[model samples]
Target: MRPTLFLICPVLLFLGLSYLLPFLGIVQLSFTDPQPGLAQYRHVLSDPLTLAVIWRTLRLCIIVTVVSVGCAYIITLLWVRGTPVIRLLTELCIMIPFWISVLSRAFGWLSLLSNRGLINTWLKDAGLIDASIQMTRNEFAVVVGMAHYLIPFAVFPLATAMRNVDERVLTAADGMGASRLRIFWQIFLPMTGNGIIGATLLVFVFSIGFYVTPALLGGGQSVLLAELIYLWIFQMPQWGMAAALSVVMMIAVGGILVALMRRNAETAK
Candidate 1:
């Protein structure tokens, strides 16, 4: 073989052996465990608890994806439009969150969202509310932490797309008497469609697989599919069930990606 093939061979071999083999094993186990049939998949799909968790997971992922993309778009706009100081500060704010450990970020939010924590205490002392609100161990807290963690993933792709948008086009439109919102709707928004799609997919996929942040924040009442998978594997030692859920997650993610790619391709043509 050639020199490039020789260089790539070890990495390919490692991936096949380490990653592919284990995934194939999981797939096999999902099918063959407890007598060869589709019982595991049927259980996952038909069980009320499993179905509820799936719905909750999808809902949370959708909310996180939308919120993260919206916030990232605004941040990108600010980064692009602001002065040197504003730009520097925005960059720092966006980058700093990614620098911290995600677990630390989750814990930080846990503290801030707790009843006696900063916000509630200040609110009560200020008489903003009659009592301390339920903040931590809830859906609200999960979304907040997940959004914070995923914002950087959303920002980079959006910023890249927004940067490629021609300011000269917007300036020309302004000279022609177009309003800012009109300019964005007619010109900028259409231009950044690909980036927006990419960022949405990235955030959604990451949110679905998320474990620590949601587990810490979502409480017992709001168990996500990831948590359900964890419960099966570690708590109950139901390997077949865990493997089945994993397969479903993989299939869902793969289907989304395939659809996105096909849509992008058709749009390109």
Candidate 2:
């Protein structure tokens, strides 16, 4: 084998053994019943609750990706357009968020958004809120937590893409009397938009699979599909049911990922 192919094959083999084999096992389990049939899949698909949970999961994933990418876009722009000191500070802040455990961050958020927590307490003292705002354990809190967790992923792609953009081109457009928004929409955004989409898809995939942030922030009520799957697999040990849900979610993610990759390819040209 060529040296480079030899180097890559072992990594590929490892991934196939670890991720692929487990996934295939899940798929096989999804096809089984208490006696071995497609009952598990039919039951999973026929249920409205499963559909709702799946829809809610997708909705949260989309919202989280949008929020994360929006933040990333602003941060990237500031990093690209601002002073060296400002750029350094923003980059440092983005990295700092990643240094802490996500669970720790989620816990901190609970305090900030809780009624007795900082925001509500401050608001109460100011007479702004009649009661403590209960943001913890709701859909709002889940989206917020997921967005916060995914922000670094979004920023990494957008920042790298933005950095690679030739400023001289934008400067030239500006010199030619293009407006700021036009430069962004027609030039800057479009240029980096592929990377943004890739980041969004990546974040969305991760967010849909997320359990900890949602469990911590969503308070066990607004249970995402990931939580549902986790319950079935680990807590309940209903391997067939869990496998059914996992197969569906993984298929959905795979389709979205294919679309994302194709879009990225077109954007590359």
Q: Best lDDT goes to which candidate?
A: 1
Off by over 4 Å in 1: 1-11
Q: Which parts of model 2 are misplaced by more than 4 Å?
A: none
* lDDT per residue as tens, model 1, 47-125: 9989989999999889998999999989987887789999999999998887899899988997898888888988988
Model 2 over residues 12-37: C-alpha lDDT tens digits? 99999999999998888888745588
TM agreement with the true structure for every prediction = 0.93, 0.95
> Which residue window of length 10 is worst by lDDT in model 2?
26-35
Residue 268 of model 2 has an lDDT of 79
> What's the number of clashes in each of the models?
0, 1
Please report the TM-score between candidate 2 and the true structure.
0.95
Q: What's the C-alpha lDDT at position 109 in model 2?
A: 92
